[model samples]
Target: MSGSILNLFSLQGKTAIITGGTGGIGLAITTALAEAGANIISIEVPHDPASPLLRQAIEATGRKITVYDCNLKDHESIRATFHAIWASGSVPDILVNCAGITRHMKVEDTPVQDLDDVMAINFRGTYLCIQEFGRELLRLQRPGKIINFASIAAFLAQTNISAYCSSKAAVQNLTRAVSNEWAGKGITCNAICPGFIHTKMCEDLYTDKEFSARVVARTSMGRWGEPEDIRGLAVFLASAASDFITGESVFVDGGIMGR
Candidate 1:
């Protein structure tokens, strides 16, 4: 293959904004994008200790990273962060909506507040970021990429996470809606559904031997996913490598969904 063909995956000179880029799968995705030559802007909540670590790691790669402390659930906060990002002279060519929350409660036991919280952080927050930044990309006539973080729960119903599953499903649909609306404007939107990744968020489940065994047994890979497992897909989605793909939900679940 020619060098130009191979270089389609290169993200040189691109800038990326990653929501929830401080830890877990978010951190891994941020680093991978940075290593692939994209300037990183990590959006995190205030006082998150992991933010500094993530920044340092990305900076060590000789790529620039800017950390903004903004509450994803708060509209004003998100607006302010965007203004700051623009003022700082970083215009994003890619956006990864990785910030999200889940509440573990059965449908009968789920409080209205819990459901509202999940919707705010997972669905509404993602929507707001895309709307605001996407407009800028469109106005500038820049071809941009957006990757939303969905979950395998969006496809498979799980116990004690009714609100989470519903919110993720909304995200998947929202990706399609956004892509359909903006495809003519040179923007691509898609969702990533991850299953049982070994992140801090799922440490408790992994710690339980019986539960872990059951999860492993259900997966065709017979193992849980590592944070790094998601890096390549994230990079591919953000680069020109996936330019022809949009409005699709790609699963990175170790084949668990097939079972």
Candidate 2:
């Protein structure tokens, strides 16, 4: 209320580092921040296929996009990537932990390896990014925001994808832990728990007409969420508008979990 809404959301001159910038959700967030005048730094796995198009999309918004290849599971690589960004004279003011993977398997059927893999990226990887990002911001003596890509599953019980759900649960608490430690300083950590959005992760589930219908019927919106549905919230969290907000997991679930 103190500032113009436009100014509140403007990320002009801010630099954001996003993990999984080539994916559906990540791409939407990248474009949104870019349109709001923030320079983009996308952290992705080596040899990612979606790099070219993701780059073009951000550039099309008339903002700069730099891609960094880092394995989140490898602390050294993650550290080196941030070092390179700092060496290049660009410090990240925002960190978006959007890189996540899920496997659709029942609890009984979930393999030990699958759980490790999901936890590594969805949980451990997020922790690692927050660690490095916090280190950079504290060193620079600046304020920063961290937006983690959690899921509706974090709060509600769901069938299959046990590993994914548990990992997201970890993410929710992790967001709290990071914020608890950093909010008093110069950093605010939060999460966006998306519902059933139409992305590569849901392609197979969408193919199951009955299951899809059930999910839709449960939601008051009676529709699936698009990548576009998440862009505005992503911008708000990354901007000064949400300075007072931290350590909470907000939902964009289209009323699915409300029931």
What ranges in model 1 sit over 4 Å off? none
Residue-pair clash count for candidate 1 = 0
Would you list the clashing residue pairs of candidate 1?
none
What is candidate 1's lDDT per residue for 40-131, written digit by digit as tens?
88888889989779978899889998778898889998998888988887776999999988887679998888889999999999999998
How does model 2 fare in lDDT?
A: 0.91
TM-score versus the correct structure, for each prediction = 0.97, 0.97
Q: Note the clash tally of each candidate.
A: 0, 0
Instruction: Note the Cα lDDT for every prediction shown.
Output: 0.91, 0.91
